[model samples]
Target: MSNINPFDKCPVYETINLIFTKVKEEDAIDLFECYSDPITKSRMNNDNCGGVWDTHNIDAVTKGIKGWVQEYNDRFYIRWSINHKQINKIVGTIEIAPVPNTTRFWDGACQTGILRIDIISSLENKIVLSEILRMVSDNFYVDLDIKNIIIKATKDDGERVLALENNSFDKLENSTFPYSDYYIK
Candidate 1:
């Protein structure tokens, strides 16, 4: 299943005024910084993980991005770093992965989108989140694609969930993967 090709050209997500680019080694510090906030990290990693503050694992983060890039190059996975142009910082990440074509019954299960966008917990940033979602939805397009998208967030991530819904995401009840959707799961 590692043969899909993402568009070589960078896609412009105007609402957020950022370009979706492959996650790179250089992104380690920015990502760590964004994930450093206890609230932000907990919200994204279910509070069970997220030691980015004290345990600033730059090597691990860089290696993770390298692996992601390698997987993208092989078409096994796709990961993008969300650059917040307004602040000139890397705000968060998004990804898509092809279901492995293995003997598992769910082989060819479907492509899935995984997104984790960081935003200030203010009312104004809620609008920013919505705009970001709009840009993401409009700019994302590729083959082996799935009709549904998923997102993952903790219970405290209500604002993000709301923003995603406002932009066209439906939550799946009794689901258990960060958030219930094809894009963020």
Candidate 2:
């Protein structure tokens, strides 16, 4: 089989108010701001750190994005920077990968296109979130042949939970499952 990596090529998505582009080493500070936001931190599971997802330290954040570069090269998963088109700043990130084969789905088997949107406190709303999700689905899903995508919502994030539901995500009854909801198209 050929050995080309999925992330070897760059991807960019332009929406009405935002853009999704490749994450880079220079995005360390902006990434830190997104990951460190209290609402962002409180809205998702972050038990695993030691990467760009680490909110407390800039060095850790830098190390994290740098490592994501490596991870991209390795073709394990991919993260894209979410930038405000008008302001020209990264407000969040989205990590996409295959469901790790350990998690259960509606059919009770792991699936591809498991996703996580890590955004700053402010952008966690219906309008922006809907646009981001639409961008990903409309742009990348077919190229990747994604069967399903999932987003985990924190216990206290009622707005996000509602958004997920509105977008047709089925809530996995067992909260202990790594992600709280799943989306199939």
Candidate 3:
């Protein structure tokens, strides 16, 4: 939405080959198609595991993607559609948030924290992830002065884990939530 150039050259920051391009509102439909499909949803079993669920009802998903773009377009960082060069299709999405210097998660010695990334299973491969992480680490994360990278993906999301491990993502910890209450209620 904003005219900010996400791919602008910066002398202070080094650029990674993978570009974190903003996902447009119009692209939500395609995402829904990918995310809602049985094969696609089965590949990644996060919150949207139950076949898109009712969260996609009433245009909520579309609105959320668009709003996220507007909010994080020029913020410290944000997510982007993972556009594979060979495939030439946005097989997945990833988030890169630049942690503030003052956050409690900082180690004091590091000026910047980590850039978190999220991805779908469609792009889950060692080679594919290696290229993407290289792009992010070299082009985006390094420029942000970040020392670490974090990823939030599902356990069944093999591609994300494979890519994360290939990119040197150590497991922080495990997080669990009571799902039946949220869904049934």
Candidate 4:
């Protein structure tokens, strides 16, 4: 595995339909749309992360983006804006961080990465989610040096659950978090 610090120079990933890059101040408008939407706010996984997902204005979104940038500088976690290639707009943000040993996992102990994907409800279909998960599967394991990746998917999110299942992620039965089911790959 490479010992490179991903935070040193943030990595940019691109797939046929999406592009992932470090969140920027300019993304406030597009991101505000996601944050302010009721459906999108309902699907966001805000566990562990201190920030509130829902926002009422562009300033809140801009402040949030600044916080994300600060978090990146501190090497806490890297948040990437998920840009839809066809629309040339940011549809969501994905965060990947090394799972701290303090957090409980199904297995006793293992190297893991915790993934959080917050996207617009309109693009919450299996196809779109599958593509995003595929990009994570293809790159994050090696980049983060983790044996497994875990994500929280609520039972109500049928499309996201299907996408997780289709992308080699299994529902973890013994998750400590009660709000949502955790999936591991």
Candidate 5:
């Protein structure tokens, strides 16, 4: 495998209906729609991350996007804006980062990617999630040099749970995380 860092030049992932690319300042308006929506925030997995997805204004959204870019530069994580093809707008963001030792969630020999996906509640269905999950499953392992992918989905999130299951993600029954149930692929 190549030793180059994927964060050096964020790779864009595309599906038939959506595109995932590094979050940019220009995405503030569209992202604000998602960030400010209570429904979207309800489905987001903040977990150990200190930041909250809910925002009150575009300024906060803009600042958040800048922080995400800086985080990418620091190799802390890669946050991608999920753009819908038909709508021609950013529907949400997907954050993929290495499982930190602080979490103590995975004891596996190979590294694992912790995925946090937050999309507009209207599009937060099995079909849309399955497509996004498929893209992650197909590329994130080799791109991030990880053997597994893990995500959090609450029991109430029936669509997300079903999508994860359809994409070959099994629930981690003994997960120590209290925020929600975790699934591994």
Candidate 6:
């Protein structure tokens, strides 16, 4: 298990246009808007493997926030709500955690961190997204004390793939699991 609760020091990063703050229960509307968008939902693949989530109701998002709180109890996951400070809205979310518990018996056990990102549809938000990617990459790449960091990228996410590549995250193949077809850091 992890020695320190990473959430305790959850850093609040700010850019000229955004604020990355610890997500709390008060962010229901902002989170709901983020998770309910069709494009965001489709890209996240939260329904299957990724810890990302898609919700039809604000209550579901509230529950998801609680889930993050419980994940802290398990000492495994923490999510940050990406708030646009000027607009007073949560435009997206970012989650970082130890990879979920599985693939140990056959896949080999090792310490790893997974970063999950989700944002509402904004055709002009590329710069904001890029900055967030770099910020998190810098924090997690060597600072997290984990051997590896994994990012789940869909085949069509060119911008995201490019950001990961810019941060020195190559196509990680078979560190512990067979990710020959997956991009990781």
Tens-place lDDT digits, model 6, residues 83-123: 87778788888877665455221123535766778888672
Give the alpha carbon lDDT tens digit for every residue of 1-185 in model 5. 33556666788889999999999999999999888888888777877778655488999899889998998887678899999999899999998877763432122343777898989999999999999999998888777777778899888999999999999999987665454589998
- lDDT by residue (42-68, candidate 3, tens digit) is 543343223443334428658757766
The local lDDT score (0 to 100) that residue 95 gets in candidate 2 is 78
RMSD of 3: 8.3
TM-score of candidate 6 on Cα atoms, chains taken together: 0.79
The deviation in Å at residue 128 for candidate 2 is: 0.8
List model 1 lDDT by residue over 34-70, tens digit each: 5555566555432222344342577766776777687
- lDDT, ranked from best to worst: 5, 4, 2, 6, 1, 3
Which pairs, if any, clash in model 3?
15-138, 15-139, 16-138, 16-139, 17-135, 18-135, 124-159
Q: Relative to the true structure, how large is the alpha-carbon lDDT of every model?
A: 0.56, 0.69, 0.49, 0.84, 0.84, 0.68
What is the TM-score (0 to 1) of candidate 5? 0.91
* Candidate 5 least-lDDT 10 residues: 101-110
Identify the runs in model 1 with alpha carbons over 4 angstroms from their true place.
1-4, 7-16, 45-55, 99-112, 118-124, 141-144, 174-185
C-alpha displacement of 51 in model 6, angstroms?
9.0
TM-score of each: 0.69, 0.80, 0.59, 0.90, 0.91, 0.79
TM-score of 1: 0.69
lDDT of 2 by residue, 1-185 (tens): 11333455656779899988879888888988887787787665543333335458888888878877777776666788888988889898887765654432222343556677888888889778888877877755554545667666665677777777677776666544453344443
Each prediction's Cα RMSD? 5.2, 4.7, 8.3, 3.4, 2.9, 4.4
- Residue-level error in angstroms, candidate 5, position 86: 0.9
Backbone clash total for model 2 is: 1
In model 4, which runs have C-alpha deviations exceeding 4 angstroms?
Answer: 101-110, 175-180
